[model samples]
Target: MPYNIPSGSQSNSSGVALARSQNWAFNPPSIDVISSLHILQAQPAAVTLSVSIRDMLASSLATTHSDFNLGITLVQDADALDLFALSSSTHTISNPILLDAAVLLSMQLEVAFVDPTILLEGRYSGYIRFSITATNNSTSIVEEVDLREYSLNLERTGSTTNLLTPRTVNMAYIQGGVSPVLDFDIIPAAASSGSLGYVLSHQGDTVVTLAGTSTSNPPFTLITGDGAVSGTLALDTTIWDSKSLGIHDTVINAIFPDWNVILGMDVNVAVFNAPGAIVAPDVLEFSTLVPDNPQEKFIDIFSTNGFTITAPPWILLSQSSGVDSARIGVMPIDVSNFIQGTYQGMVVITASGNIYEVEVIYQVNDQLETTIDLMDVNFTKDNLYLQVNGYDFNHFLQVESTIKTYDIAGTEFVTTDVVRVPFFNSSARYDVGEFIHESMRWIKDPQAAALGVLDPLSAPARGLYQKLGFVDFNLKVIDRRNQTVRFIRNLNGTKWAPGRSPFNDSNGYHFQNFNDAVARITTEGFGIINIFSKEASSLVLFKNNVEIDSFVLNGGDLPSSRLLIYGGNYLPGDIIKAQINYGTPAIPQLLEKFFVVYPKTDYSCHFLFRTSYNTLEILQCTGKILGFVEYSRQSNTVLKNGVDIINHIQTNRVDPLKVNTGFIPEDQRYMLDVFKRSLAVWLVVPQYTQPIPVSIESTELSHSDNDRFLHAYDCEFKINRDIDEQIYLF
Candidate 1:
């Protein structure tokens, strides 16, 4: 049966039944007819809907369609188109297209197509246009795009090496712009023999050097199947000079002989640096001869240059001098008592080069003794003391004393008192008893020991007495008239002067009394008073008598008092005896009244003005007074007649005038006139009279009867009137 199909669907109108039918015809079939029929029927429905993504390229003047130019590219040996191809839509047209149509359509196409069969063969070659254009339609345009594929092969080159090795051994590369980078294992050389190698090639013909010339070389070590062997390389030239080896040597030596022998004296040896190499010995030895006796010794040394062995000058010959150089010498050679013996000492030599030592010995024969002076001790008290010197002397000394005593009558006595003087060191007490004993021993008289002695030659003896509370009361050296030396010592410490009481009692001895009545006058009030005595005889009475006067007496009135009868007048060749009274009122009181008498040969007067009324009635006189008499008192009316008497004498040169009725000396007439005038003024004149100025002159009178008579009348007038009467008398 044969079947035929028609296009379009059959439709039926209303009310009419429509049916569609196919006819089948049977005939002898030809193969060409069937094949031609199949080809014609598949023509439109078999059209492929292939959509490719490609870069669109458009410039100001041109546009490119590159979808048709897309060709199969391989990526890492796989078909790139296959990456975008859906396996389920390989031959069917029902699947959605995955390719980007806009990017493909915008690209400029170069070769419009690639044969699919060639892609199947893994061989592709095609061109696509990439157009770059400015948005402003500018003419600057570039139209090329490079297409690249990445093929990576990871590998390690050569054998495994330590990580510390330098990276300059193996290398890697990629061809046709393939990025070639690979990570490899860093295996130790002890574990691996070689590293894997990687190769990358494009289409097999364009081969890149497997060990790329541009790639960095990886570090590696060569392994001999055991351990790694480090590659030997040339050292850097910059550091070659620093590596070197140094050698050094030091040498020391003793230049002198090792053994030196000396008989009985100091010996010296030297040490020095040797010419060539020489090592110092740990120990050095020296030799010397032993002497028959014992002695002190020393050793001296010299320097390398042999300079006379002056280092540490004069090495001690004995221990007393201390140690010095390296030489040996004997001192104070007393070897006769010593057995045959060797005396030795060591000398140490030290320097920066080395240290060494040597021994020295010597012998000697002699005698020695030590001596000290005895007079070198300094005694504290030199006169009566003795001191011992040196370490081997006794300190004690023998002592003796001689004493003397004398009575007031000058009788002397003696006594011998022996005593021992004790020795004392610096720390002991000051021996006062020793001082007194020594002082007494030096005294001239033994009886005076209790009374004490005066030894001017012995300062220590004197000092001893002073220390024991003895005072120098009578240290006198007097040459008496009998050619005997008289020394007076008043141990009672008494002194007296005229008019001073020597005892504490009132009736005790009086040192001086100028008047015989002073004893009676001062007996009731005789304690003490300052009295003036004019002459030495007056002082005798004040010292020997006990009376003193109460009336104010003058130096001239003592002779009239008769208390100073014998010595009242001081004469030449009279020795005045005096003493200082220190008891009772004290010595200073007696000295107040005592005065040295001087002779009054000429007449002088001192007149004191008592009244403001200066009257011409009294006539001043300058002469020695001979005598005086007192007159009876009278009234003013009666004294008025006395003024007439004075007027009578002055007016008339009459002898035996009433006022001059007495036998007046001719020189005394003027004075009698003055007296009578003063008496009249005193008795008859009214009170409160105005004063009249009067001149007073003191003059020396000639030693004549006339001057003497005038002086006598003046004194008599002064004695009759009180000082207030304005009377001038001398």
Candidate 2:
């Protein structure tokens, strides 16, 4: 074969090369745009007197759609002939073409004038250009790619004398004699035979050749049968049960030795050990998905040849020896010898003289466990109760409130400040004062007490140490891994219930002076009683000693009540309890909410606070002329003042109200400690006659002054708001 390449080695470089074996007669020559110029150099070129175009199909690339597209697209036109009407394989053109002697004069002088190939190709179907470059003395020929390389007939993969390759299964995973029969497309159905060659070592095999193909080229000694027959040729793989494996190759040769054609096929066969004794599942994952479990699991083994089972000492097998088949129970035996940690072990079963290992493993230790146990977190009565198991966590409280600060001139500006306690473990049933976040927890500082905000000493850390406005309280609970979270939010969009524990104490809403206020059931999914209760007395209301009202609620009924303490519905020291039967118990759980009636205040002391039990404290003494006391706050951390100034600030100025405190010879001093430890405080004149706030005066009551009050201690109050004219807000 010869390739007339004008110049440059690239396929696009002017050239036309043909392979002797290529027989493509009508397909589009891939024009490779360089459709495989590689073939041109593969075999040395020899100029022959004549060579058929069919030979070019062997190495040149070509493509054809299922339609009538030949070497080149033939578009429909009035002058264009239908290409499909002509026979492709054997038909000859009706008109013969003749080239003028002048055409030869322009053609290469190097090509022999008498060449037969030039005479055979008797047509000029299209324009052609050919030239010789003087620089390299190379002939540059340009012909239509369609007519020259592709018009040759395409013989996709085989020939008449050449056998069409058989479909062989390569790298075929066969278990026993079960495999596909070789379907050879025999060229001539008779007088053909083959030799099967193999290589047990080849990971994957498809290549078939005449030489050293026996070990990689490992002989298929046990497989008996001719390579392929007329159509359905199956090899006798029955005896292939031995661990012999690899690719099997069949080289086809005519029954007569004289037929020298080297045609062949290769079927990749990965032979697996035939079924003898076997376990259905290769591996079993037992136990409770837990590393260590006491549960036992069973596996069945089957074998025509009786099987024997063996495993490590710790792996106990119910039946070690069986006839043809048996079900065996397995479990770990002596785990008691192992410490309180994970111990891993594996097991294998030897069935029918074959080592079939069903690798199973189990490791137990302190490394694993369960998921988040946060069913819900709620404030029952006073304590914030959470349903969590075996987890050590702390609560997070994010609070936003109006922080009031005054400049040296006493010009106060209110701003929002967010306070956080990530590890809040506040409790009301118990004292967790030590666990309270320091920055926001109350300390006995006179600045806070002197600023008309009394002590919250009864409980240190309430809402924000001693701060108020105290509106927003957003919080969460995070465990050690930081992977778990449980949070509660604003109950009514205005008040946070989980943050308030005041129900247990005589504390309720600040009321802002509503003659009567409605306490609606706020938390969603939580109700004092099932609104669906049909019983006569589902919700009962108590006033002091007698039952004042009862409500039988049905569906659509609002689970709420209006407490009228101010419109003479109740009296001072009156405890009105609203109880509801709730929960899953047959008798029902009694959940209670209450309201304590305090006499309409002339001057009142309101403490904005929170504990597991109390949210706020409003204390007014019954002693005549004495309301809550008040004192002036200084910016200094330590304030030095005369006992006279502390005990009695002159009324000539803004006299601290001297209300007589009917006392407790020792233990009852207006709960002064609670007055000192309040989270926030506001002294208001209920009349709104004066908007300016006042402070409880005289810091006389102390831990040591318990016995100092004889019969009573006159309480003094001061207007913390130094402004003369009354102002409303702090």
TM-scores of the candidates are 0.14, 0.19
| lDDT, candidate 2, 1-730, per-residue tens | 1121111100111111111122222122111111111111222122111212321122232221111111312122122123112222222223221211111211111111111111111111111111111111121222222132111111111223424344333323244645444433444322334633211111212222222222223332212123332433333344344446543344433221122223344443445454455464566543321123345666666554557777788778887876545557787666655544434455566655777776655443321121111111111112222222211113333333322322111222233323322331112121111112121222113233222132222111121122222122233333324534443443212212222212222221111111113232111101121121212235677776578777653321111122222213445666666666644456665656555655554323222221212223334433445433323343222212112233434333333455544443542332444454443333432332222334554545322343573344455555554434221220
Per-residue CA lDDT of candidate 1, range 1-730, in tens? 0011110111110100000011111111100111111111221111122323233233111232122222223222233232121112342223222222334432111111211222211122111111121111222222121111111111112222222123221111111222222222221322324522111111111111222232112222121212322222211212222323221111111111111110111111121223111112322222111122222333333222111111222223332221112233433233334443344544445422344454443322111111111111111132123232111111222222232322111223232222222222211222222333322332222222222222211222221111111111121222212323222222221111111112232311122231112222111111112222222222222332333322332331111111111122334323233332323544332421332233432222222221111112222223433321212233222222122333221221212111112234543343333333232222211111221122221222233355444323323221211224232110
Error of 2 at 388 (Å): 14
Per-residue lDDT of 198 in model 1: 17
> By summed lDDT, which 10 consecutive residues of candidate 1 come out lowest?
12-21
In model 1, what is the error at residue 280, expressed in angstroms? 39
Q: How far off is model 2, as Cα RMSD? A: 36.1
- Once superposed on the true structure, which residue ranges of model 1 sit more than 4 Å away at CA? 1-392, 422-575, 579-730
Q: Provide the global lDDT of candidate 2 against the true structure.
A: 0.32
